[model samples]
Target: MRTTFDFSPLFRSSIGFDRMLNALETASRIETVDNWPPYDIAKTSEDDYRISMAVAGFAQDELDITQEQNMLMVSGQKAGEDKGEYLHRGIAGRAFQRRFELADHVKVVGASLVNGLLTIDLKREIPEEMKPRRIEIAADKAMPKGATKKIEGEKHAA
Candidate 1:
């Protein structure tokens, strides 16, 4: 049986968190997802990330990687069926498509396939406007250095 979660309560008080809430809800809905061609996500640096996937028996031409919006898709398909027969076939040669949700500002840098491992590099580049900046507070406009002051109770001549 599949279970669903309600996020209506969080929607009322949360501001600018629609993406996070949606991702959480989406994850909850996919309870019995496939784990084919296992993969790992690792943080290489403060803003650098890497996704390594085991894709044995798959050639570079048979794999496709794409990014649209905040979603990254990686898929593999064998070119053709093997004509030779084997007494015991253990290696799995199946077509699979895996999707990953990426956070804002996260972009794919490069991808490589070496020794049956498909590694994808990513970098999070925060825009200049979004980065933290110190605001300069003016010191009350310096009070006009030579300005004259008058008493509150005294009257001024026109």
Candidate 2:
């Protein structure tokens, strides 16, 4: 089945860069291969998020996490053993690569492996100026009369 996406309307508006929308489209069109590792993404807070991948047989030294150009990549590669002869190989200890598109201003805090699970934490840091703030209007400022000078918008044309 073919799917269509009309993003012309979004481009016309001031919505800015549609990174999330693009990510959705990319994810939908991605082809699944044999080397797909199980993973989970969880939102810890308004600005905090965590991504965990199941790497049972992979060691800590074999896993690597890096952020490049707004993209988070996780890869793992198990070293081949020369001394052991595998009678039966059921568990997959092969190399795998996973990519995740990150939104603007999103940063990777850190990553750690514990109990056969690799956990990576991310945080979105919004500057104080970018955050929402309330503008308080003084009672005196609201009143137009008895003011030292007329405000720019206060004066009306006759």
Candidate 3:
């Protein structure tokens, strides 16, 4: 069963959130999205994250990781090889692509393929201008030398 929602009403009132809403709509419409190459997203620290995917038969050279804006894409393509004889092919060796929507300042730090697991590390490094800052309120008596001088009210011709 598939459920549909009307986001037109939200679009009317919200501004600059079209991308977010579009992402949500895309997620909702993807009913048959494949869950191939199982993955896990973990928060290793306050600003650090890790995404680990199980790539049993894939090698580091066969995988590609890219970041475009706030989206992270990880794809794997099994290298072409001759499969001679196989009685029972149980382990699924298939190509897959996975995408992750990251927050504003999130960035990909590094990635590593170890023991059939491809782990990608991420860190959120907020810009100095965006980070919370403490404003120092100036006291009336302690004003700076040039700033202390006040001018009388004067009218200017427009």
Candidate 4:
């Protein structure tokens, strides 16, 4: 069952949150039954993240990881089918695909497959202009360099 949330009220009162609201909406509509090839997401640091997936029986060459814009996709394809007949089969070696949504400015730095775990590293690097800065509060007569001033409903460069 899928639950729908009404964000019209927030859209009417809020600004610059359309992207966040869209993400929530998209997440809510995702199917809950496609949980194969279990994975874990961890925040390694304030701006660093790690995604570890249990991709056993898959080799590095058989897996593909791609990042386009803010979306990341991971997929695996088995090379050949097993020839031996087993009484009990536990390990799964089937082709699978998984996707992950990345935040703005978050980039995939590296990835490694060790043992049966596939680890992906990510880091968020904010641009210099986007970082917070302290603004100087000048006196009435004091004006900062390259500042703009308004006079008679017209903006004047100062």
* CA lDDT of each prediction against the hidden true structure: 0.94, 0.84, 0.89, 0.91
Report the lDDT tens digits of candidate 1 across residue range 1-158. Answer: 66688999999999999999999988988866688899999999999999999999999999999999999999999999999979999888899999999999999999999999999999999999999999997775556778977768867899
What are the models' TM-scores? 0.84, 0.73, 0.86, 0.77
Order the candidates by lDDT, highest first: 1, 4, 3, 2
By TM-score, the candidates rank as 3, 1, 4, 2
The count of residue-pair clashes in candidate 1 stands at 0
Q: Which pairs, if any, clash in model 1?
A: none
Model 3 ranges off by over 4 Å? 142-158
lDDT for predicted candidate 2 compared with the true structure: 0.84
Q: Which should have the higher lDDT, number 1 or number 4?
A: 1
lDDT per residue, candidate 3, 1-158, as tens digits? 67898788889999999988988888878877688889999999999999999989888899999999998999988789646798888777777889899888899999999999999999999999988999998876667767756688988999
Instruction: Identify the leading candidate in terms of lDDT.
Output: 1
| TM-score of model 3 vs. true structure | 0.86
Which regions of candidate 2 fall more than 4 Å away from where they truly are?
A: 2-15, 33-35, 81-83, 138-158
lDDT value for candidate 1? Answer: 0.94
Q: What is the per-residue lDDT of model 2 for residues 1-158, given as tens digits with 9 covering 90 to 100? A: 66767665766773756776677667667665544689899999999999998899888889889899799999998877646789998777878999888887899999999988999999999888988999997675365667676457666789
After the best TM-score superposition of candidate 4, give how far the Cα of residue 12 lies from its true spot, in angstroms. Answer: 5.6
